[model samples]
Each structure stands twice: as structure tokens, then as C-alpha cells.
Target: MQLALSTLGCPDWDLERILSVGRDAGYDGVDFRGYRDEIDVTRHPLFTDRADETRSRLESAGLSISALSSSITLCETDDRAAHVAEARRLVEVGDTFDVDRIRVFGGGDPEDRSRAELARAGGETMREILSIDGAENFQWVLEMHDAWTASDDCQQLLDELPADNVGVLWDAAHTIRLADETPRETLDALGDRIEYVHLKDAVYEPDHNDATDDGYVYAVPGEGDLPMADVVAALRERGYDGWLVFEHEKRWHPSIADPDVALPAFVEWFRDQR
Candidate 1:
């Protein structure tokens, strides 16, 4: 698997710093979750008006824009038009960089609506987004997050979407931490539908903690309890040669290790495994 760094790891850095850090750390690419203060990076000038310049910078840094991580939630029933617009904008940004994958979230509270209802809504929403002109140029990968942490739950939603261009962005940590699933079980269920991955490690703390309310504190890849080794082995066994984006959530959790430290640590650890 190729290694990449998520800008979500270093929210304070500008594009130049992001490219520099990623290059020096030996990453093959950078996943754009956001840039600096812009959570929706498509709105940022670097991705909008100056996208070509940004692409040139990436090329010079010897890194590719692996994927554009959008905040487009697939399950929300309200603001359908807004969601479609956001997806369209993302497509434009992605096209400029020649990146063919966009990350989306299965975001809805399951307690408010049943998994079946959310899955139906998400599928419908994704279909509309895919119908947009030029949407077919990219593969939309729904992340295993929020209400869709379980492999079976994701499969129910994936069943409604197109198998060829729509797939799962397998976040192994979520399956293990939230759904109590092993890496092998998640791989078996999702299989080839997993088009990309979000690599992170976490320690499960049953009690409330500073890192998260969900009992999982983000850790540097090898320093946590997330069965990351098993995840890698499972992916290798399946012949999954895809981007493993180190999703260090330093943007949200300021107390965590800085990207400068955590990013290289992940590269070293993952390379050692290989």
C-alpha cells in the first residue's frame, strides 16, 4: 500500500508547508481534508481560482492529491440541493487535480432514524450526486463513520449504490472501535467495494476522556490498540494496493501530537511493516 498524509493532520499549515512536510516525510501523496482554516477546501482559493498553481506545487513536491475529502454527507434528508451543489464543486476541484476519488461520509444519527431509513436516503442522495455531469469521472467512497461504522450497515447502503464507481473508504479503526469487528471480518464483508482507506490508530478508553467521547483516543499508528498490523496484513492478503491515508485528527484534537512528529512516525512504522 502507498502512504499518504491527510491535511486533517496539520490544519494550521499552508499549502507550501503541507507539501513540504509530506515530501520530507516520504509520503507518496496528500489527502485534502481541508487547508488551514478552511474545512471545505473546495471553497479555498488554492483549490478554486488557483487550482492549477496548486497542482503544479503538488507535482513539484513529488506528491499526488490522492483524494479530496469532502464534508458531503450521504444520509441527510434535508438540504438536498445544497448537497448536490457541494458535490458538483468537489468534482470541479477534483477534475483540476486529476484526482479520481472523493471521500464522503455516511453521516446521520441512527437513534434519530433507523439504519434502513438512513441507508435509503444516503443511497438516493448519492445517486443524485452521481447523476451530475462529470461525476462519473471519479469514484465516490463512503467512509465508515457516524451511523455507518459496522460493515453490515455499510453493506446495506453499498448494495443500493453502483458497484463500479461507488464504494467504501474502509476505516478499519472505526470498525474495530465502534462495531467490535476484526479487520478480517470487515475485509470479508466489504471486499472489493473498499476503494480507499483511512489509516489511524486508537486506544479504547471505556471511560470518558479528553480525546474523544467515543472511548477511542487517537494514537500514533503503532502506539495504540487498533489492530493496525492485522489491518495491513488483511489488506495485503486481499491484494489491496491502495492509498493508506494516515488520518491523524490533530485538526479536531489540538492536544494530540503535532503532524511534524506523528506523520513521519507513521511512515516509519508502516514502512517497517512492509
Candidate 2:
């Protein structure tokens, strides 16, 4: 699998720094979760008015855009038009970079509604988004997060959408930390439908954890207690050759290692696995 760096790791860095650091760190590409302080990169000038310049910079650096992550929540019933409009804009930005994968979130509370109900809502919204002229050309990957961390739960939502363009962005850490699932179990459940991946490591801290309310503290890829090696092994066995994005949550958790430190550490660790 190819390794990529997510912009989520360095919210403080400018676009130039992001590209330079990622290329210097030996990453194959960069995944745009945001640009500096702008969580919606499409709204950022690089992706909007100066899109061609940004594309030229990426090509000059020999760095591909692995994916574009958006704040498009599929399951939310409110602000349907806003979500669809955002998706359209994301498609426009993605086209400029020839990026085919766009990350989305399945954001909703299962306690408020059953998984089936949530799936239906998310599916309807996705259908509307896909109806956009060029939207069908991209793979809309629903990230395994929030209420959709478990493979089975994500599958329920995936089943609601068209199989042709919809798939899962398997967040390896979440399946283990939140759903208590093994890598093998998650792969078995999602199978080939996992079109993209977000990899991070963490140690369980049941109490006094300031980084997260989920009882886990983010760690550098290999230094943590997460079953990362097993995750790689399972994906290899499945012949999955996709981007393994180092999703360092530096943006959310300032106490974690900086992108300059954590990003290269992941490349070194993952290379050791090979």
C-alpha cells in the first residue's frame, strides 16, 4: 500500500509547508482534510480561486492528492441542501486535482434512531449528492467514525447506497478503540468495500485522558498500544493496495507529536512492516 500524509496532522502549516514536509518525509501523496485553519479546504483560496496554481505545485512536488475529506455528513437530516452544495463544490475542487476519492462522515446518533433509519437518511442524501453531473465519477467514501465506527454499522449504511460509487473509509483506530473489533473482524465485515483507510495509533487510557473522551490517547504510530501491525497484515492478506493515510490528530489534540515528527515516524514504522 502507498503511504500518504493527511493535512489533519498539521493544521498550523501553510500549503507550501504541507507539500514540502510531506515530500521530504517520503510520503507518496497528501490527503487534504483541511488547509491550515480552514477545515473546508474548498473555501480556501488554493482550492477555489487559485486552484490551478495549487495543482501545479502538487505536480512540481511529485505529490498526488490521495483524497479530499469534506465535512459532508451523510446521515444528518437537517441542512440537506447545504450538504449537497458542499459536495458539488468538493467535486469541482477534486476535478482540478484529478482526485477520485472524497471522504465523508456518517454523523448521527444511533441512540436517537435505529441504524436502519440512519442508513436510509444517509442513503437518500447520498443519492441526491450523486445526482450532480460529475459527482458520480468519484467514489464517495463514508468514514467509519462517530456513530458508524463498527463495520456492521457502516455496512448497514453502505447497503442503502448504490454499490457502484459508495464505499467505506476504514478508520483502523476507531474500529478497535470504539467497536472493540479486531482488524480481521473489520476486514471480514467490510471486505473489498473498504476503498480508503485512515491509520492512527493510540493507547487506552480509561481515566484522566485529556486528548479524547473515548478513553484513548493518540500516540506515534508504532509507539502506541493499537494493533497496527495486525491491521497492515490483514490488509496485505486481502490484497488491498490503497492509501494508508497517517491520520495524526494534531489538529484536534495539540499535545500529540508535531507533523514533522509524527509523519516521518509513521513512514519509517510502516516501511519496517514491509
Lowest lDDT 10-residue stretch of candidate 1: 204-213
Clashing pairs in 1: none
Q: lDDT for each of the candidates?
A: 0.88, 0.90
> Each candidate's TM vs. the true structure?
0.96, 0.97
Off by over 4 Å in 1: 205-209
Clashing pairs in 2: none
lDDT of 1 by residue, 157-183 (tens): 887777777989998888888899999
- Give stretches of model 2 more than 4 Å off: 207-209
Return the lDDT, model 2, position 251: 88
Candidate 2 global CA lDDT score: 0.90
Per-residue lDDT tens digits for candidate 2, residues 62-176, read 8999999999999998978999999999999999889989998988788999989989999999999999989999999889999888887788888898899998899999999
